[model samples]
Every structure is written in structure tokens, then in C-alpha cells.
Target: MLLEDHQLQSIQWTELSRGISFGVDGGCLVEAVERLGLVDIVTVSIVPGGQIVLEAPLGNAAAYWHPCFDPGDSLPADWAGRERFSAVRSAPIGVLVDANGQSSFAFSFDCLTQEGEIEFGASEEAKTFVVRLAITDGLAAARSTVRLAVVAPELAHEQAVRELSVLLHDGIAGRQASEIAREPVYSSWYAYSQQISHDVIMRNASVASGIGCKSVFLDDGWQKFGDGRWYAGCGDWVPDTAKFPDLRGTVAELNAAGLQAVMWIAPFLIGEQSAAYSGLARYATHYSEHLRTWVLDPRHREVREHLVAVCTRLMRDYALDGLKIDFLNDVMNYAGTPSTGDVPDVGDAMTLVLSEIAQALESVRPGSLIEFRQPYISPAVAPFADVIRANDCPADADQNRRSTLNLRLLAISQVVHSDPIMWDPSAPVEAVSRQLLNVFFSVPQISMPLDVLPEAHRARAAELLTQWRALRDVLLGGELSVGLPNEGYPVVSSRLGSTLVVAAYQPRLLDLDLEGVSELVILNSTASSALPYTVFGDVPPVGSALAEGETAARVVEFAERGFVEVPAWGITRITLGA
Candidate 1:
């Protein structure tokens, strides 16, 4: 309902719901574009420096590619200096490109004119600008690349317009059913190993409400496990008496604890001993036989109906809030043959299954949050999901670090972003806290296990979530600013009005001209102390080409200074009035 039209000095923009038109002031560009339907578009200016190139993403031919770093491939000498900013996360945030190829950032959504405040004018007071993009429905995509495009609103909607109109016809090629508008994210039960206990679930949920977190998910090990089967004989959703002791009692307690109970369910993968499999079951697809554990025969109307019925009973009988639909790895490269000669669109099959499951859940509880973990099919899954998990967390710090790179890279290349609520690994308290803080640079929840944490972690989790909930609105809704990252550590800062949130990892120096910024929040991930908080009007006088327009101020560091050294791995907040 809100529309923003920036007045570019070089062009005048006109907009209508049907399409857009543009006119030029002193050039032929507008004249050519106006005839071609380019108007009110997100604009990108290619500053000639930093040898960054833009390529078209695989499926989307309209957008351009960007700068990249390949740890796997040997590159030309000094590759870092010769590149463009291929920062997809920063796409929503303003990015700074330096002459020597390094990039810093400052996100200023506000525009202004000569007067103090300009209404919808090119002034610093008005704030609202975003890249326009359209998501097409029923894509015939194999893989996708992250390509950034400077788009106008009209252009963004135009490209995605087809998706809105396309209707899914049952078993008719790729399209399956009508779409809905709610965005979704999925839930997971701490990777594949669910070792969760009833008491642990209740303890976690009790605190989840205090931190304003929702979705009390009782992950793993609840189903009765039988002999000679790892995950078999557990397809039926019966609580393990050994684990739950009083299963119904536990569900009742969770409801009273102010948490929406969400249980994890893997649709397929029946163990050989499972009652459903022990009796007699036909392969859903001939390919299901090849899968490790038994794959559910979703193609069978009975199987689909039974799956829906069980899920519905959890709500109707148990009063559970939602379900964490897990283990979709089956579709990862699955090329199964249906019974007939007609092959189903692999993408369509995935979509249909998702649609059916989503419909079943909604019919039971109109507002239930259906979460899934499909980082691979993120772009496709994003529109339909309520929550999306980035991926299962690896067990150690090194793997945890790799997850960051993979997750960030995935966010860009796939052109989709998701938050992983898995607990921060048993890392150094500071490391864990700062890691969570940085993840908050984008909108993600801090879903960590606080019950078993040692003293420091418990304190950090409580303090971090407390502060996060108090400022989540600002973090989720404010303008973003990111700085150049160093090896092993990174820094990103954001501001919403007078409140400033800055999170820094490892020990380092951050000197940037936060033009209108009046605050600072620092989260030091390193065990050592950092210097001081004095401001300097320029980039550090290091061995470099600090450009002419790059005005900056340094917050002086006091080595061995007592008060200003940020806590090892603690989030700190500061306020500045501009």
C-alpha cells in the first residue's frame, strides 16, 4: 500500500498499477526506456574501480552477476583488489566500494533536498528504498546463481507478475495449486539426532516465553525405538514411555508454559520394524525402494491421506501448536520414475507435496507455523514456508565457522536468506555470544539451549536474548550498515532512530564515517581487551588509498584502558544523537 517515488535529477518517473513510464531531463536514456516500460526502477550505478564483474544468475537472465572469491580455485594475482561487491546480504544494505577493491558500507535509506526535510524528495529526511524483484512461479530451474540487479518497483513486479497469475493444475506438468501470501520458515529438531527429553523440552519452553521466543519444538527421540532398527518402528507418532514417562501430561504442561508446541516429523524413512512397514506397504515410487530407509508412498492416495490424518490428530487430540516438517533431503537429486510413462516435474512433485502438507496443517489450525529445512530449494520453498532453517549445525567450532561461510554464500548465490535457530555450539562464551550477535545483523532468532549452559553461557544467553527482544523491532526494521571484513573476524553495525546496535567479533579496529549515526553497540568475540571509544574523521591512516570523498572519524582506542575494552564475546550498546 505504501509507494515511494524518488525524484532523480536526470529523469522523471511516472507510475500506474498496470505499468510504468519514464521521461528524461537531459539525456536519451529515459526516452529509450520510457518506450520500453522502464520506470520507477531500483537504480545501480557502476562506479568504475574495483575489478568486479556482474554475470547473469543461471535461471534469472535479467539480473547481473558480481564480484566473487573462490577458495577452491587459483585466481589471478591480487584477485581481492580486482573485484566487484558481490555481497547479496549487503544488497539490502548500502555497500561501500573502495579504490583498492576492499568494500565498506553505510546504508542510508533517507533522501533529502536543499531544505531541512524533503517530502518524497532527494533529501536526507525521507527514508524508504529497496531493490525491486519478482519471483516467478513454476520455474523450470535446475540450479540458480546469486545475481544482483538494480531494480525499480515496476520492473520488480513485472518480472514476477507471471507467478502471481499461474494456477496449479493437478498432475498437470509443474504447476499444482493456487498460492497464498503468508511467508513461511521451517523448524528442525537439532539436526537429525533428536536426543531431546520431555523435561528438557519443558524447561526450554518455560524460558522461551520470557525471551519472547515462540514455537516450543520437542525435537528427537520421542517416538518408541525398537530393536534392530536405528530410526525404524517410529513412524507412528506415539510418545516413548521411557523418554516421556507421562506424554500427555508433558503436552499439557507445555501449553501452560506459554509456548506453542511444535513437534518434529520426518515424513518418510520408516525403519524395517515400523508397524506401518511391517504389515505391508507398496513403494510410493519405484525409486522409493532405492532410498536408505523406507520412503513414504506419497503418490498413493492412502499414504497421503494417512500422513495428513496423523498430522491432524496431533492438533485435534494433543492440542499441539504446529509441526516441524523435517528430512526433505530425499528430493535432493531424486529422479524417480512414476508408475506411468509420464514423468512428474521433479520441482512440481516437491511443490505438490509441500502444498498438500501445508493445506492439511492449515485446515487443522489456520495459523500454525509450518517450518522446513530446504536450504537447497530455498528460493522455491521460501514463498510457501513459514520458517526456513539454514542447515543442520556441525558439531564443532571449525564446522560452525564453515556453516557461516556456507550459509552466507548460500544466502547470496541462491538469492534467498534464512535463519537457523540451532543452538550455538558449546563454544567459548564470548565466541558463542558474538556469533549470535552477528547473525542478528539480519533478522534471525537466538535459539540456543540455556538450561545446560555453564555459568558464562547462561549469563550470555539470558542477557543477549533479553536485549534482542527489547530491540528486535529495531534490528528487524531499521536501516543496515556493514563494513569490510578481516580474516577470521567481521563487523556489522545497524541503527534504528537513536538506538544503535554494533556487533564486532575478534579484536579489531573499526573507524568509519557513520554519517548520520549517533550510536554504537559493540560485541567483542575475542578473549582479549580492545582499546578505546574516541572518534576520528577518517579511515585509519594505514598503508592505503583512502579516497577523497571517504570522510571518516576514528574512535580512539586506549590500549590497556579499563572501561572501554569490550567484553570477550559480549554485546555492548551505545547511543549517539545526530
Candidate 2:
């Protein structure tokens, strides 16, 4: 394997089957080769410092891939080829940590065109940390290059992330920026699903505006014949007069109500019943049995132009504020289909289409928001999107948090958003608050029907959303700290200058150094009625505090020396004295 430190010894390959070979090329590139009809595994061992921090492409899926632990022990042989919605879960980057929680070494894939995975596990027999690079599909027969670096242990995590970002940016082509990247949005997917109408949308937009949501996204059911069939009206890109007699008027009404209008569109998918489906048969990548639709081949210039034109017209015709592009990952090249254009790979083609769409839309509506989700969330496509949201996890709060953090760590300057929060409205206020707390670090998109919510739920939601808006700047742009994967991120906090915001997902003792912190707001996500915390540093005992939600007034002060308890599932703002 390639080593950053020349003094380091060569990698010892414990198991190298006959069909595969490893070598160093140009004194820098580490090349691994596998012949036809052979499944090979390459293993390397190293002794890292104190705690090892493994960075996975996606969120924590302990059963499949763990950052510091070996998921191979329980992983099935077919795990490498297992069908999944995202490829980040199997991304080829692994960061090694030193004793003091600093980065010691890191391994990354320089080639973005191929699909691969780097799995780590402790080798008890070898007494050294083992990493297995599992390359398959496109790279199985061809050569694959993996880059290794020995980072200085003194490098801070943020610095390391910045460095990594630069490296990735150099390798990729675009960066994303938008004014609405961090703004709160209201989505109709979870709330209305396929059952949507002009009245429902206008009603939701009015309510969303009252709660400080800046944008209203009409998702999935606006196009003609877009009812039960998800993409039946996809390629046409025309409004369904049945659902809304005047689509333009609906958008105008939303704008009148003080909400930016955003719509969801899938550019690379064509329903079988669509008029263009039969005519564009040559542009089909493959007929997806799962989606029951034809995935458009993005490599074709004609197809890319069509997508760009459709998006530009939406902005020019309806005066939309943004477009949420869904199912972008479907445009990737499949094994059996040969590309129809000069593009070398489908990824490059996908990026090209995205760039064109972004440019065209922005030209019509400057600063228009373009949003994408996981799988297609690589640095290469960042330039084409203003907001990158976590893949849909529905009511699972932990997964939503983990996904949001994963995107935030990689997307860097881009707005990272949580999956639309859709929970049972009848649930306890505390439980509902837990869902909100999980995604507190990123932009929150609410997708529930607030009009039908209970009075108590409505009040609680309003209070939390108001508080969220008050702290939006710091929470979105501040220095962030997250609990390790092992702990399931029970605590996540962000600090901007002297102001700190902390969200506790579990009942754990939290210690904060309030040296420069003037205002500390703690949000408890636990089920308990109160949250116990400790504060130290240059701050004195709390003088006065305001508790909103279920928090009782008496529990605001530090009940036990240095320990302060606040109401659970609510926000508590604590003022510190010098």
C-alpha cells in the first residue's frame, strides 16, 4: 500500500488469492488488481493512537458498516453487492485517529467514477487494526487506486475536515451556494402524499408562514396524471389541471401569503404511460422493475437539454423559488446498458445535466434553490445544489439526525437539511420534541398538517419553531461537536462566538466550559421531566433563566452544586454571570 511516511513498512497482505495482485505505481498510487472470475480480499494492519474514529460514507449502520469496529464479522459475503439506496454507506474513505481524538492517518479513493467500500475490523489474531478494501462491479476487472496519507496527530478535527474538503473539491467540479440553503421549509410529501390539491397546499402554506417557514414545497403530485403512480406524469412536466385549476394562481397565492413556492421534480425518470416514453426509447438506461418506469440515460445530450428546458420553464412560467430534484442517483450507468453519448461515465453525464439545470434555472430566477439528497450527495454535485437534504427516513429521528450530520460534515458550506419530520400528531409533546431535537443541528423541514394538530401540539410546535428561528444563525453556521458513533450521538452542540446551543438526545451528564459563552440554551430530548447538566469555566452560578414548554419554573436553577436541571423535551435559555 502507498504510505505517506517513507519510514513506514510495506503493507502485509495476509490473504491474497491467486487472481489478484497489489503494487505501487509512480511511487504514489497504490494499485490493486483483480482478474475475471475471482473475488479477492486485501487486508492491511496498523496500530493507531488512543481512539480510532472511522468515517463512513453514510450514517451509522452498525450491522453493515461501523466506523471504528469491524462490521465484517457479522457482514454476509454478499454485503458488498447488497442493494441499497445510497453508496455513501460504502464510500471508500476511512480516517484513523490518534490517542487524543486527533487524526493520525486517512485513506481515501481518488477515483470518483468507480464504486467501492473500505471496511475496518480489529484482527485479534494479528494484534493489529485490519482494513479490507472491497472493490467490485466496475472495478473488479479493472485496476483501482487507493490513496493513503499520514496526517499529523496535532491536526484538529475541523482542520482535518477542511483539508479533506479541499482535496475532495480539487477532485470534484462544483460547489453549492444559496440564500435559502439554511431556511426552514414546509414540505407536502409526508403531510399529503399523493392526495394533494390546491386548497390543501394553500392551507398548509398559510399555516407554515404563521410558524416562520419561509418556503412551501409542493411535492410529487402536481404534474398531470401524478396521482397513485409516482412518476406517470414525470417527463411531461405539465401541471395537472384536475388537482389545481390554476397552477400559476396557486403559486401566486403562496407568494401572496409570504411563502416561497418550491416544487419537486425528477428529471431522469419517465413513466411508461408518458407520451415521451415510447418516443425516447433509445434514451432509456433501463426499465426499472422497482419504480415501474424507464430511467432516462443522462449521457445523451438531448436528454440533458430536455431536463434543463423543463426546469427553466417551471421557473419562468410559474415563478418558482426552488426545485427539489429527486431520484438523481437513478441516472448512474448500469452494467448492461452502453452509453449513447460521448460522456465516459454516467456520473460525469449526471453532473453535466445538473450543472445545466442549475444554470438555466438560476438565469431565469437568480439564486434559485436546487436541492438533492443522498447517494447523489458527492462533492462533485455540490456546485449544482443549494441545499442537500438527508434521505427520507420518515419517523426515525435518530437516523434523520445521523444522516443530517453525515451530510453536514461532507457538504461543508452547503446547507445540510434534515429529512422532513413526520411524526404521530397525537403523541406526547415531549416525544414529538425528541424528533425535533434530533435534527436541531441542521435546517428543519416540517411535513405534517399543522391545521389538524391538537391545541397542545400546536402550541409546543410554535414555541420550538420560534426558538429555532431565533437560533438559526448559530446552529447552522457555528462550530459543531457531535458525540461519537459508539454513543449514538446522545449529545450534539454548536457554539457561535459566546453563544452555545446544545441538544441532548439521551439522559447523560453534560459538562460545558462557559468560558466565552454568554448564553447557553439546552434542549432536552429525553423522556424524563427534567434534564440534569453541569456548567463550568468563567461563568458563575445561573442568575435567572426562562423555560418554555413543559419545564416548570422551580426547576430552572442549579438544584445541586454546579448541576442544573431543565424541563425535558423543551428549550431552556440560561444566562451566565461573569
Candidate 3:
């Protein structure tokens, strides 16, 4: 059993105990990805002793089976009596060996790992591969790094957050950040260039003084989305020279407002149409004949140094506090160059890229925030990450709620987590809006066009945030108890310190009976419903089951443990003071 820990350095993996050496450098996998629930790293070296048993932690039982996809193998004429698992899609998983300038290797996984040949090459080491795996029952799980160092951190604050989360699980309320030293925890805004104006950023900061907008984020669009395309042209990392000429001035305004400035930086790109693509072309890995976008060759030292320099310049130029790394995943999916290139772990090249990004970013700003949006990457890579973006898009509250719940399920395994229930600037607040409200009890994020919100709604939002911050300690440091209750309705409840926050919804009283709830709050994550419940344990200060005394439920004896109902989709807070 050969095991390796990928840090910020590369350690050549040679089978010494077994006594086998392939010259000085015997091809080794450097990184891996922990996507879905399957771990994809090179446990088995290509030379020999490469087969490693893919297993989970003790006590957590799981099943494994590989199903391939075919256009027309066989299909039942009817929908009934069909296996749900029968219809699925898959790809190949193999090792890449750089022969001179070209690269290729082969590996396999079948109903059983027998008689499977894998081969892919020429691939300069630029793209990152997605070694898909189905994981079950774990929060914040990290995939194994094959035989190299350089692991990526989701954000700069991950270390502090994960450490604090562990302490929080033990009922301690302590938080650390680069700035605050230690107070008020933290929150970040998703700053979208197309939507957020200086005014919006200021207002969001002002509004957040109450709820929890610790830091303000500036998402993509500073440049252009696609051509001057999709958000991929990260190589041209300066504030889209056209968007905001005075980047320093704009960010300065946020800094003065006491809001930390965080910027969106893909930091790497290769479009022939792009300014640097022609020059970067010499170092890119050729994956497609179309040649629309080229993979960046991190294996090339110049590319690495240029990325570091560019990032440093951006930070210095904008006086920004943090950065959101968009696509380190390019490592695995990319093709590597010859000589100076290192291969990604078995099937996780993204891990290596992420790790490299973390080191480079930290060298510039030790506590830089590195937000990665994929959830599966959260666990296998959270220790190096600050904030994990649960999903790419925040469609609605219910969807967000499911996202939040699924993410929570990952939390027991992930020591660090971000609040879901997001509000993307362009996302309409129709369906899942209520779900976001309910999700506040879990990890919360408000990614909406909050600054330009109607005055009345803004005021209401402001008021709610103020209350949320008051209980920040309780929210971040409480014990979370959850229930699927047969999937009829989804409910997640957290008992933080003296307060208990619960988000519940269902059709015609979904039948939820909390066991040890001291404080009760109803969240409207679904369609509007008439809530029929009251506070169970300690009496609340302001809003309680009695506020709507007549319309809502108010059971005197069992307010503390019985079931309750809400008529609409939204969130209500109930506090319990000792």
C-alpha cells in the first residue's frame, strides 16, 4: 500500500521498499480530484503496484458498480418495470505519459477491473480531467492526491474556518479571519460586474451591517462573458480595461466602507483571439482539432511565473483583499508539455492545479480567499479552501435548500461550509426564493441584486440581516440535527448555543416532530403555507408563535417538541436565551 500527501511541494514517488526504480524519474501521477463521491487519484503506479482498493471510511457502507452507456444496446418499450440505474453515461479513466512532446497512457474500471485498456495522449499537460465518482454520506470529503504536492485551498480562510468548524461541532464559538483578527465571523457578496455598480456595493455593505455581509465579492463580467467570450479568458486578468478604468478607485471605495474587496480572477486563458493566446500558444497542450480554446501548460515554468506575477500585480493594482479561483480544474482536463510537466493524480489533475494556485496566491497574500464553486471538490480540497461554492448556479430557494441540505450532509465530513440559499444578481426570486430564506439556519449566502432592491424590500432585508448577525455566534456554533422524514418534506434544524433554527416545509402538514428543540423558527423554502406551530422551549424576545397569535398555531404545553406548520415559503427566527 503506497500512500502520499500532496502539499505545496513535489515529492518524486519511487517504489523503494519494493526496490524498483525507473531511472531517476519513473512517471508518477501528481494530483487527483474528489468529485461526486468517488476518489480519483493514482494509487497504482503505471510501472507496477498501481491497483489500489477504492474504499470509504470505516462504518460508512457503500456499493460500487460501473455501468456504461450505449446509443441502442437494448431498451424496454415501456417506462414501467425499468431500472433507474440502467440509463447513465460514462467516460474513460487512464494514466498520461509524456513521450517527448506527446502524452498518453491507459487504465480501466469495469463491472470488475479486468480486461480494460486505456489510452489518451499528445495532450500537453494543460487541461484537467474529471474522474467522476459517486460518494455517499460524507461532508467536506477530500480526495486523495496521488504522488505529488501542491493541493488547492477553496479559499484563504478555509484553515481558520475548518478549524473553527471542528471547534463549533464541539460547541465552541470562535472564528478567525485575515482582517477582523477575531470578531463578527464573516460573510462575502458575489459581486457581478454586469449588475453591481459602486452604489450597489456600498448599499449591500450598508444593508449587511445587520445580517452578515462581511466581505463583498465581485463575480465575472468585469471583462466579457464569451469572445472576448465566456468567463474563461482569465489570462487577461486586469479589470476589463474597458469596464472600470479606475479599478483601484472603485475598490478603494469599498475598502473605505469597511468592506473587504474580493475580486473574480480566472487568471488563465488561451483563446487565439485573446491578446496573450498567440504567445501562450507555444506552451499550450493541443486537445482539440478545432482549437477554439487552448489548455494552459502549467508544466512550463514561464506560465507558472507569469501567473504568479499577474496575480500579484492584480492584488497590488486593486488593493483587493481576496480572489476567487474559477477553473483550476483545467489541470486534469489539460494536456501536458514535455520535460518540465507533471501529470495530475490518476484522474484528478484539478487537484494539482488547485494546489498550485493556493500556494501562488498565498505567497502574495497569506490569507487570500480562494473560492471554488463545486461541492464535490469542497471536501477533498476544503482544508486548502476558504469558502466552498456549493454549486455553480443558484436557481431558486427550494433548489438552494436541496443544495444546502445536500451540502450539510457533506458538512459532518466537511469542517468548513458556506451558506447556500444564494441570490445571484440575475436569478429571479420566484420558486426557490423561500427555500433560501429557510436555508439561513444552515450555511447562508445572499447573491441577489440586493443593492438595487426596492426600498421597502431592502429595508425588510436589512432588518432581517441585522437580526441574523445578532445570532451569528449561535448560527455558526450550534449543533445541527437534520431529517429527511421519508423525503416527503425536507427539514434541517440547528441548535446553536441558546438558539434553535429550523427550516421546514411540506404539503398538508408534512408531519415533522422535532425531538429536543428549545427555540423554534419556521423557514418558508417552499410555496406559501399556513404555519401552525409555536416556540417550544425558551420564550423569544420579539417575534414568537404569539406574534401571529390568531392565524398561526400556538400550542401551550407542547410548543417545545410538537409538530408545526407554516403557510408560505419564507424564514422565521426563534431565539432561546439561557
lDDT of 1 by residue, 161-235 (tens): 211112111122322211211111122344224566676676666555555455456666677772222455656
TM-scores for the candidates: 0.59, 0.81, 0.59
On lDDT, the leading prediction is 2
Clashes of 3: 96
Which of 1 and 2 is ahead in lDDT?
A: 2
lDDT of 2 by residue, 197-310 (tens): 898898777778877688888999888778885565568878888898988899999989988888999878887777877767778857776667788887788888888888
User: What are the runs in model 3 whose C-alpha is more than 4 Å off?
Assistant: 1-212, 224-233, 286-292, 335-353, 375-380, 411-435, 441-443, 485-489, 507-517, 524-555, 559-567, 570-578
Once superposed on the true structure, which residue ranges of model 1 sit more than 4 Å away at CA?
Answer: 1-193, 203-214, 226-229, 278-280, 285-291, 297-303, 336-343, 374-377, 395-432, 442-452, 481-489, 497-499, 508-513, 531-565
How much does each candidate deviate from the true structure in C-alpha RMSD? Answer: 14.7, 7.9, 13.7
Across residues 402-441, which tens digit of lDDT does each residue of candidate 3 receive? Answer: 4444444334333233333344334344332453355454
Write down the TM-score for model 1. Answer: 0.59
Candidates arranged by TM-score, highest first = 2, 3, 1
Give candidate 3's whole-model lDDT. 0.41
Clashes of each: 47, 2, 96
